[model samples]
Target: MFRFLTAWIRSLSIRRIPMKIIVIGATGRVGSTVVSKLAARPDIEVYAGARHPEKVPAADNVTPFHIDLHDTKDDIKESLPEAGKLIFTAGSGGKDLLQVDLNGAVKIMKAAEEKGILRFVMLSSKGSLTPDLFSGKNPSPLANYLIAKYYADEWLMNNTHLQYTILQPTALVDKPGSGKVSLGNYTTNETSIENVAEVLIGLAEHNSSVGEIIEMSTGNEPIPEAINHLS
Candidate 1:
């Protein structure tokens, strides 16, 4: 397994990687973080999709557009335009998880497939795990959130076509990103959004991430260097 992993990493030495990203829910928590990371990298160009397109933050190489997942098919297409890949960082309204989390995601997937984009990354909660860490004890007091995440994960997994990576992140802390992380089927207590962004960046360049579900949390390690250990 180690040999196979190392060989896989070594094979990714190709020059000129294309990175045109369409970041859905870019104004949201994880979406914003992803946008910030891409802004700092010269190799990436990000399209920020938001409900209030004009409100999307202004940053280097970032383009904001109005895109409500509930909008009409033509409306969604108009906002998405051309992009190489997509990231879903949006949240479901209240406990209507199936409405947005499941259906919204499916709609987006179909749209991307029609537009010829193959890579997709999603930001979800760690609560989605089957033997949930907090299952025995009600952690958030709102179990439905986790329930929604579970369905979202299943939908992506059971579906076909796009190469997808599901990221189930730990507690979202308010620290400036250090870019280090710890990988586990379940996380401890908390982590910063910055560190999560670092992982998203790693996935952008990682082909092995296809069909994989990774859980992350803040660790003693630095954020930027966390993914280096993945190799």
Candidate 2:
């Protein structure tokens, strides 16, 4: 009877385990929203990664994890929680592109790979897939940023063994989300920050768009329906 009781307790522990998702850049506008959305789901536990984790809002199932993208691979890996999925929403905003955008992102990818994280979701820019579109004599000022995203995205796709989803949204706006989006190659050049966060939550929950780069813009389709259509 003691052995039976032990087995039952172990099974209960297994069944009660929640899915842990680590959101890098949780202090950012998009990342913070993602953290809040994921936290509302009882089955999900969110690890909000930020340099200043204290800024992460207090919430049940939400743990603030300190992560410095500029840190070494070992240090970054040590700081990361043991999570099943990781979302890379961190960016340098062109302040220190080489260090923060390119190298910093690659470091996290390496750490995630080493940690055996199952999935990686990257928040990229819309024109990252095609560099030539923005390059030439009179290139857009965002050329450098797009280039950084391109290489980082390439590394994620080619180098990592983890299942990955790359969301590429055009110029972000602070407007309220309509809970809708258009997925594909779009030239509208405007997407709501809230919509991006909502889509990130959908991707995390459904595990859709793996191995796919989705270009997004503001649209009339519901977020869930758009995500389902992609799947």
What are the lDDT scores of the predictions, listed in order?
Answer: 0.75, 0.89
Candidate 2 local lDDT, 112-170, one digit each (tens): 99998868989999878797867889777898998889899999999888789999998
Model 1 lDDT tens row, 154-228: 767776578888887877887887555776544457878877777876776677668878778776666445555
Structural similarity to truth (TM-score) of each candidate: 0.81, 0.91
Q: Evaluated with lDDT, which candidate comes out highest?
A: 2
Cα lDDT for residue 139, candidate 1: 58
Candidate 1 Cα outliers beyond 4 Å, as residue runs: 1-18, 72-74, 93-96, 131-140, 185-187, 222-231
For model 2, the run of ten residues with the poorest summed lDDT: 180-189
